[model samples]
Target: MAGEKRDFNTAAATWDQKTHRVRMANNVAQAILGALRPGPDTDVLELGSGTGLVTLALQPHVGSVTAIDSSPGMLAELEKKIAAQGITNVRTRCVDLEKDDLPGPFDLAASSMTFHHIRDTDRLIGRIFGILKPGGKIAIADLDSDEGRFHESNEGVFHFGFDRYLMRKSFEAAGFVSVRNRTAAIVTKPGPDGGVRTFTLFLMTGEKPARETEGQ
Candidate 1:
């Protein structure tokens, strides 16, 4: 949450007005569902859950969700959605996961298109590992390096995208096992040049070793 953090507070009002963003979130949510298969017993921790597009979608399938974002504006919008829908399983928190510690022995820690804003992927992954319960799963959906064209401005963006192989390495370095990645979704948008370009969103999942069986 540094280096020209996007004004998510200001952007929160119109965040869901864009059709492309909604569609992309739906696609990412489906990818999470397919990978994790969250049930009523599952407690989910969502990182960078701006506006709850993916958060609300996944809420019905899981036991409970703690959606964390750096911007209170975004969480406010998410709260509105939760209230409007009369959903009780979802909650929102405004915090910078990059600098703060979250209390969650979550069954799954997941995010969509949030990794690029983080400065240190390895550190964030390791932090996630610490908060998850034994055998908890991690799933992330993010862009493949596009040379910083994924947004209108790259002011707050850390990594334009990520190398899938290296991302897996980071997970493994965090002591997560059974790590794997897949093409979660593809988003086509207008580039800065006014030309249509497609970007890859990958879903990477891994498991923290259970206490009883390390790396089992």
Candidate 2:
């Protein structure tokens, strides 16, 4: 969390071996599908899509997916999976979505467990708004407000979870409408005290409203 560097590259090879992590991704994907009910015409852009856990889960439901992340190692692993499975619609990009220009105009944008690593949440949301088609939607799954104890070490964590009400405000500030959230998953991990701690995952969804036409 604070002192150590959490390298997804170093962890990529064995990432899917972690059963709980995989389960968490599946849960997040299910929650997103429940909220979005995307169609075959939906083009998806996923941010911080580590190893394509959530990306692959949602790939079958969408027209296409461009999964982006900052870790080359993680992307490599994802590439392996796509190649092995002959996945034709999902592609990967290794870049910082917060600063880089990506090919988009997507119908949906989604992420799982990646929001806490971002420092400027509102800016990213606004950027997504700009990249998305009007009436496009976003589904982000993350931990609820926790007092900095979710991670064992603070690698690149920017927030110790988030407040749903305030997060809805951020969505609105980015011109998103019909914002809503619900508990998506419950995970238990060994806390710093060596005991099991339960953490709640939330799936937050919102839609970008169609812009108004110029006044007549």
Candidate 3:
């Protein structure tokens, strides 16, 4: 969380009022987890949990989740959701992922719509791989393009939104094998000025190969 971190605390307060936005975000979050296809015993770690929109969606499919975010306000919202749902397998932590050492060896690591604010995506991805058990998977879902300054005044680092080439290169350089990018239908919605606009979201998936078994 650096560069221009969006204040999710503010967003959380009004998120319910924004029906279209909330539904759209939840839909995307669900889709990200759906694609991961984690089994019942998988241990997951989510970066930038942001109110547990994705964390809760993942609960039914995995053994446990450790959700991390930088904002206490956002984490508080997630806690409320957890309590309401009677979910006990989810844990939340507020910390800056860029500078913190997270406990890991997670079977799957995920982050959604959070990379744009990061200054070094490569280093971050490598750190993720280092903490994952060999053969673990990583997935990141984020904006494919800024859609013409949607938050011109407040947008964060946002390096390569439309450039999958650059993003894939960075993932591979981070030591992830079998990296691939998936593009989904452009999401169209009404802008602040009452005009419709479209933006594409991309999912990047990668894997760390399993270690060679002893005596192989």
- lDDT (CA) for every model shown? 0.89, 0.89, 0.77
The TM-score values for the models, in the order shown, are 0.95, 0.94, 0.87
Model 2 backbone overlap count: 4
Alpha-carbon deviation at 138 in model 3, angstroms: 0.4
Candidate 1 local lDDT, residue 99: 84
lDDT of 3 by residue, 12-121 (tens): 75555755445545666566566667978899999988877778878888899999998888888888988898898999998788889977889999887678777777
Model 3 whole-model lDDT (C-alpha atoms): 0.77
User: For candidate 1, what's the RMSD?
Assistant: 2.0
Ranking by TM-score: 1, 2, 3
Scored by lDDT, model 1 comes in at 0.89
lDDT of 1 by residue, 1-216 (tens): 237667888999999999889998999899989987889999999999999999888988999999999999999999998988899999888879788888688999999988898888899999999999998999999998788777887878989899999999999989899999999888899876879999888999999988745454
TM-score for candidate 3? 0.87
| Lowest-sum lDDT 10-residue window in model 2 | 1-10
